[model samples]
Target chain A: MGILEVKDVSKRFGGLKALSDVNLSVEEGTVHAIIGPNGAGKSTLLNCFVGKLIPDTGSVMFEGHSLLGIKPHQINQLGVSRVFQTPEIFSELTVFENVMIACFAKRDGSFRLQPFKTVENETDIVEKAEQMLVDVSMIEKRDMHSASLSRGDKRRLEMAMCLAQDPKLLLLDEPTAGMARADTNNTIELLKDIQKQRGITMAIIEHDMHVVFSLADRITVLAQGTPIVEDVPEKIKGHPKVQEAYLGTAH
Target chain B: MKILGLNEKDSRFLLIVIFLTLATPVLLQPFPEGSGMAQFNAGYPDLMQRFAIFGIFAIGFNILFGLTGYLSFGHAAFLGIGSYAVVWMYKLLDYNVIWGLPLAVVVSGIVALGIGFISLRRSGIYFSILTLAFAQMMFVISYSDLFGRFVGTTITNGETGLQVYGNDPQVLLGATEPSSPHFFGIVMRENFWTPQFGDWQFTFNNGYYFCAVIAILAFYLSLRIFRSPFGLMLRAIKTNQNRLNYTGVHSRPYTLAAFVISGMYAGLAGGLLAAMDPLAGAERMQWTESGTVVLMTILGGAGTLMGPVLGAGFIKYFENIFSKINDNVLHQWFAWMPDGLEDAIVWVLHFFVGKGWHLTLGVLFMLVVIFLPGGLVEGGTRIWRFIRGTDRKEKTADATHQPEHVAYVAEKEEF
Candidate 1:
């Protein structure tokens, strides 16, 4: 059984079927890639998993717990972290403050009233945040404002912030989109290092074949709101249905 | 204990507040009593009392507007309500400020809870309009005197206001002598010490000190709120509520808490205003008064620790100094010039000061908003940066960064 199971899920926007009877299973401690062309139901499928949009039918289970009609925060508390397609780091705050808040959330749970406890005095959380920054190689710019950072650096910071929670499952929406070649390679290596060191289960939705082929242990191809194939990355390379999905879109 | 969760930096700020508040009488009365500039001295007990009271009002308003970024246009309702509560306390019980203050706080808190519960359901401009509507409704109720005027029936006594009268039910009073509002027999208007140095005379009254002490407490509490984790959440609400929700935080409760706290502060200031003069007027709760506090917060630099107090003092100082400047004073200053030119200069200046003091304030507000958007505090910081040859710290850096990130992390750590 997979850590995350999407069984017969279907979502519609009025007349259009964004995701129809979709079934996805992300096995624990493995990198699963969900690849699709533009306008495919990849985003819809991911949104359903995260509680942004509720499927009209089907159940999404994380270790046998159903994720339906729950708040986004509750879903997050249930060990799911989503990284947006565009970087959503707090632009107005310093790099250290951004990571520190995440550490507080990790330690304190959903609601807390330790308003009097100084952020500087919380040494353990501070240390953890600093360590996370180091892992992402962002320690040197910890005091700098998060907004001033390059786009690639913002992405890295967002990932580091997510990792700080030590979540069982990580969701990445085009993690390497808009990244320079060097930064993309660095991100790939970082993902590999994290998977090796921490064994985090990641469900990545990507348009970039290079990113998918490089990191994905298992690949799922979707065309016209339906999955055509689910197989290892090497087998996905020559799949005719995948070719039809890509080349068909070209026509 | 730490008194509102003050850190080292906050503690330092509090110390400065305490020092400045205590030194107002001396700091205000700089010139000799008979000198030409003596008229500009703000050392008078009544004016000083106004500084402290309005300082309290602005500080409380700052806690809500500055931190949460919720522009509440109805806060003056709480202040007016507080004044009424105090005045009523004097009429029903005795002329003691102590009895009125706690009741005013409790009543305003309850009122704010009701108002905030409904208003917070909508955010941004809609929320501001809702609050404005509620306050206007309250003003009508108070101004129209909805209750029947039978004995002690009229809730707010209309334009005449609810004042201490000849036959007040002062059951606590043993003395036959007429009493002004007092804190333990120390009369509000009575000056305790008047020291004269050459032609300079300085008067220190019981009321101003009492108000200053309260203002100091208010500043301390504000400092605590600004530093606390609760404050961080409010800042998060200002930045992005969606991010907070995704992070697993229910931000509504935090915003509501800030609203109630600031409302109570307004109530306290209103209560003190009544204690100082033993009268309550419906005009105290008007929308313009609400706008004045907003201007004060923005003028002083809203998000900063010391901005509200500085803004309050700055605005009040201008109101007092400018209003007192008549055409005679203007003419005197320009007498050194040519007769026609002097008359022309005074005529031009007449539109700015004296009876046109508010015009001066309007122009000042415009200039501040245009140039020093961070308010007076930013101006001070900028001047300091210039003198020290240092880089300008950006004002765009906000509280949004802290809580959203925390929530983001919380989502990840939930397992």
Candidate 2:
């Protein structure tokens, strides 16, 4: 069975059906891309996975545990980490602190009240946080405030934060949406390296064809709040159904 | 180099705090006795005790408001609860403050848990209003002695305040006990030593030292909290709760723990006040008292380690010394100025002194908020940097760097 399973999931916003009868599963240790045009329910479906939205019908299970009606932090503790469309690092804190928080969460679960213990004395956590920064090539900027980082650096830091959790599933929502070509290529390379090294299961919702084609092993194409095509990346490249979803049916 | 599990830098800070608190009686009495500026001297036992007590209160409040950015507007209720708890202990147990003080902390912490649980359900202004509402309800109950009426005992004793009655049973009282809030027979109000140096005189009292020691302990604990992982989580909450939650750190329990801890601090302060005076008043729970701690925390520097203590001392100094400056004091200072100019100046200055001391505080608060958003600690850092000429060097360095790096430097100064 897949690590994450979505079965006949449907979500509606008042009169509009944002996601309708959507069924998808992400296999273990594979990059699964959910790509759609502007009006499709890509974000809505992703939100449902993260406990930001409750589906109107059907179930979403992560490793056989239901991912519905729980808080975002609880879902994260259950081994699901999400990267937002915009970088969501703690802007007021230093880069080291931003990653250290994720490491603390990973080791301590959703909550641990260790008020008397010093952060500097926690040797293991400090080492883990430093290693994560090194992995992201952000060790030099660790002392610098996260807010001052360039957009590309911020994205990389966010990725490092997600990876620090050692999450079973990583959800990426348009990681390269607002990046320049060079930054986008850098992100693609970084993703490829992470996939090769860690074999992390990633569910990416993307509008970028380049990112999807470069990283996704399995592709699911959605149109008008419904999935129309599901296949491997090579098959998805020239599929008529995918073209129909993107460019609309002839005439 | 590391004492008390703290790093070298933190241990140094703690040592400095301990030295300053212990030497307060001497340092505060810089003016020689009977000198022209003698009126500014705040080394007296009553005021010195107040400085330490409120320092503890503000330091505690800073953990919640400063770290989590949870602005509580009803913390005074905890203070009142603490005072009442101590007084009740005195009535039921004995005149010794040891019995009452710990009870006060426990009582206040329990109460804070309830208040924090309900208030924390809402964030931002709603959370503030919720705490305020709870505090006001507490004030009304204490003011009217509603609890006393329901329980058929003198709990708060209403507007008359709660005090040890002659007829009440002091079960633990000994015939030889000094009575009237003593620490194992050492009277709180009595001064044990008065040392004179040149023209300056300093009086060291039993109660001030007690409060000073407690305040130092409280400050040390706060410093530890600031460096702790939980403290980092609280700051992360302040900056970005959304990111913190998605990272698998729950924000609610952290905020609640901070709230309860700070409330216990307030309780300790209140109990200390009662221990010194042996009286609990309903007025202690007023919203104005709640606002004062907020002022102290912000005035000192909300997020800094030493800010709250400095702010508490500053406001207390103003409340006592500046308020003592009346029309006569103003007239004495401006006597040399031409009569009309002196009269005009005193008339205007009078509004900022005496009962109008709040006006001076208001102006100072406005100036700090506008020019030094990071409060007195930032101002101190700036002046220190200026003296070292590092600020100029940094500015030059910043000018040559990329724009984003410059923003980083500026933001670092605010912390």
Q: What is the C-alpha local distance difference test score of each model?
A: 0.83, 0.90
Regions of model 1 farther than 4 Å from truth:
A249-251, B1-7, B147-152, B176-178, B393-415
Please write out the lDDT profile of model 2 over residues B138-168, one tens digit for every residue. Answer: 9999999998899997689899999988988
**Model 1 lDDT tens row, B1-415:** 2334455555666777788889889999999977899988999998899999999999999888887778899999999999999988888888878899999999999999999999988777777888999998888778877753545577899877889887878778657533888888888899999999888888899999999999988887776676566776666666556656555566677778889999999999999999899899989989988888988988888777678888988889999988989999999888899999999999999999987999999998999888887788878877887998875554334332111112111111121
By lDDT, who's the top model here? 2
Write the residue-wise lDDT of candidate 2 on A1-251 in tens digits. Answer: 99999999998899999989999999999999999999899999999998888999999999999999999999999999999999999887788889999999999987889989999899999999999999989899877778778999999999999999998999999999899999999999999999999999999999999999999999999998999999999999999988988888898
| lDDT at residue B47 of model 2 (Cα atoms) | 98
lDDT of candidate 1 at residue B251, scale 0 to 100? 67
| Interface RMSD per candidate (angstroms) | 5.0, 5.8
Best by DockQ: 2
Candidate 2 chain B lDDT trough over 10 residues, lowest sum? B406-415
DockQ, every prediction: 0.39, 0.55
**For candidate 1, lDDT tens digit of each residue in A1-251?**
99999999988999998888889999999999999999889999988878778899999999888888787778888888878888777665678777876777777776787645667767898899999999999999888877789988888888888898898899999988888899889888988988899999999999999999999999999887989999999999998889989988454
